[model samples]
Target: MERKKFLRNIVLVSLAPAVWLAACKDTGKPAAQAGEQATYTCPMHPQIVQHKPGTCPICGMDLVPFDKNNKDHSLTLDNSQIALANITTMTIGAGDLAGFKQLNGRLATDPEKTTVISSRVPGRVEALYVKETGVSIKKGQALYRIYSEQLASLQQEYLLAVAQVRQFPDDARFAQIEKGARQKLSLYDQSDTDIQRLVQSQKVDPYVTYPAPQGGVVAELSVTEGQYVTEGGAIMRLEGYHQLWVEADLYPAEAVKPGQTVKVIVAGWEQEPQQMTVQFINPALQSGSQLMQLRGTIPNPENRWQPGQQANILLPVKSKNDVLTLPVDAVIRDGKGTHVWIEKSKGKFEPRIVATGMENYDAVEITDGLSAGDKVVVTGAYLLYSEYILKKGADPLAAAAGHQH
Candidate 1:
């Protein structure tokens, strides 16, 4: 019986160790279950991990299933790295925004201030007092001389009429003849002084001098010394430089109102930008180009503005009172499409494809891919884009970046 007890005790010793090992294994089951209880993490801030689904504490981004397969759109940067990259962000919201439309234009002479010098009667150009274009002349200055047989015949008729009037002063027929002769000379652009002189001297002059009608610089001279010209034929073009016009083309979508002030920047002129008031806008569409014409006048009393110089015109486009806007710097452009970097959480950003509309110098209209109160990376968007490219070796927004149209 004692031998049987010893064998039984050895068996009990073996069974006790097995029971203790089983107890130790059972104690580890809860820890293993806890470790595998559906882990979650931030897609943007991958360092944020949790045992269950919840919002990230640092960025308020929703925690997604921790899957190693989908890491392309997600990026995580430490505090030090973010500081070194100089990253910044802004919360977009609905507000009043102003848009602008930029256009190209050219400086030109004011048409109202231009004068066309033409011949009043058919004659050959005898002599030109103004030699070339750009010659400045004053009002009443002799511009050219014309020698005409018609002028000479009128002069001789006046001389004979004056003789008849002096010989038969009491006859009304002689007075009528003298009046007819004076009328013929006046029709040929003969000045009153010249006519009176001819009557006093009883002489006939073949050539008559034409005086400049206005004071300005010659812009175009088409006549030579011996050219024959007809009545109303343009001889030259004179334009005043004290005032100028800035003209530009407008598309059908653009709206312009008279008296609205716009700013103009001359390409090569270093002076401060000039404010030009809207002088005129064509009511009908331009026939050939189908574009509308816009005009603005600028004072140039100093003769500083030159015609045909390039200019940049800025037209203020009206904006809605309440609309979400993103800074222009926040947007990214690639062959794929227009996009922006959205801060899903602090120190985390993801590429978001967006549709855009009207734009201005500083901001752009956000039509899609975001909502009000969404955080956007405005300042360091380019840096984030570069980081995404380097990390993924491909564009994060390639699939959705292509032109949607």
Candidate 2:
């Protein structure tokens, strides 16, 4: 009993010293840890500081946290902020979108094929055969009637010389006068028929009919019956509508080249669009709309195509294949690089740097840093980038802290 009591007392003394030592430790000073502040100046530019904000002073660029090692696109943004964005997805099997930039243009007649029929001498119009435009006139069809004093005077002089030549056939002076008079009548718009008629009848026709200069469409008629027209007046405008002109307007880069074939459609006409032979490319871009003109000629025998009719033209573009593609809006650019936010799975994003190529306005091809089947954040990508950027800290786990791929 005495030995047991002594052992028990020894155990109590040992336990008491330990308990007192623990009490002394509790009474001593706590450890010295770093303090937190409401705001801080950047080492590079001290003027920059914000409450709950991490951005620089000199550049207004975001400040990176002292430590951030996680890789991925999964991030959380403020609940109150919303972003409007466009989203599209694409396959990575080496192809591009088969499409083009649409442009508007009109149908017209080929200027080179257009011909203006004019009066050879000043005259008062007597009648018009093909008065309105689009009237089909055969070659040599009588187009108009004209009364010209200039022409009548020359014919009377020719008749006087012919009478004198008959009266004095042996005289050289009469022969010379008759030859000069015949030349003058020929110059006064006397065709072979008119000369033959004058020789047979011995009478000159004062009023004359001028036939169509050429066989074609009556594109325009500038003279009216009983209207006085001056010399060299445009009596009619003619073009053989046997061919047509289709004009396509494109911007500088978008303009079809001189040799490129363009497909055109005329809506009202039921027949399929005839391929027009492209003949002219406008060297100057149109000032008002900044467009270039592409012209092609097609046949229009039925006069179905009128001037200034709108037409839709299709110009196939050079195609590319075997490329990784994505919607145009998915990219977020920064000094770091061109990057995209990829979703490894739900609530996770991996920020990836990409090498990009051959971008149309709507889509782009990714050349590197992406695999064929990687799911990317097409929508809400910019927001995720902002969140991941603003959420950095010594622990970096602050914003997207709970997300897991």
Candidate 3:
């Protein structure tokens, strides 16, 4: 009996560890079940899921608590994420909607303001005052010097006529001869000051310096030094920038009459918009194009604008009162269709397919799928779209479509 009692104590001592371990497991069973009910997923890699909070196996990011039972096509971001993404929202409301057709335009020199400087006499170019093509010249400024044998002969005739007139003071024929010589010099582009100086010096100048007819930017230089040119030969072309032409192509459907007012915005200088008047509209379509030419004039008193720069032309098409409108950035267009993000609740956004109407550079008209007082994601909507795809592993539009069906 003593040996049997000793054997039983040894058995009890060996079984004590196993029994304690079993009780501890039983106590943890409830906790394990609770952990199994609450799921955790990686924010960046939604495929990585676990029953308890821990680091994600795939991305090594901290896992966040996820509600498996909550099934909805929406995204919820924390305040920190929202702030980091620069998300902004606006409430929809009814207001006056002004629709404008934005047409691509370009700044061009007005033909009416352009002038061609030509040589009035046949002579060799002695020297050019303005050598470069883009030089700005003022009116009455010396342009070029021309050495001409005909001008020298005409000056000699004038000098002889003046001597004859002074010697025979009563002779009318010499006086008439002097008057004819003066008229001939004037026709050859000789200025009154130059003629007066020539008469005072009593010497004929073979090289006569001509002055600019008007102030403008030289667009072309046709003659070089020592280049002989005939009468009416182009010396240079100048363009005046006091007013610039805004030329834009318009579809036939866009009916804009001449004398109508339009808004012109230069690409680099958008802050200063000019209210220009439509000067002309082509009666026929542009060559090799279906678009018609729309032209307007904008004053550039400072000469700050240049030709060939890009511009945006706004033509007022229609205006309506009490129409729903939203910013152009708020709408998203994709393969699924056009949609927008609407804030269903605080920090929650859902995709909504909407129909849009007239649109301009900055705003669009919301025709359907929304109503007044609905909060919309005006900015940073694309960021939310990417976040939804990352967390949901699918496009929000696809889920929206499925719900619609």
Off by over 4 Å in 2: 1-102, 167-173, 217-219, 268-273, 320-405
Per-residue C-alpha lDDT of model 1 across residues 1-405, encoded as one tens digit per residue: 999999999999989988999998999999987666766766555556666778978889777664433444757899998888888888999877776678889999988889999987778999998979998879999999987877788789888998999999999999999999989889988879988888777778888788988989999998999999987889999999788899999886787788998888888663577898988888889888879889998888668778888887888867877778998889988666888887888777777899888787667889898899899888878888766654543465762353223
Indicate the residue-level lDDT of 277 in model 1: 92
Q: lDDT tens digits, residues 156-182, model 2?
A: 888888889999999999999999988
Most TM-score-accurate candidate: 3
**What lDDT tens digits, residue by residue, belong to model 3 across residues 82-170?**
99999999999998877787889999999998999898888999999999988888998999999888889989998899899999989
For each candidate in turn, the TM-score is 0.54, 0.50, 0.72
From the highest TM-score down, the ranking of the candidates is: 3, 1, 2
Q: Which of 1 and 3 is the better model by lDDT?
A: 3
Off by over 4 Å in 1: 1-99, 287-290, 318-405
TM match of model 3 to true structure:
0.72
State the C-alpha lDDT per candidate. Answer: 0.82, 0.68, 0.87
Instruction: Kindly report which residue pairs in candidate 1 clash with one another.
Output: 336-401
Residue 348 in model 1: lDDT: 72
Residue 69 of model 2, lDDT score? 39
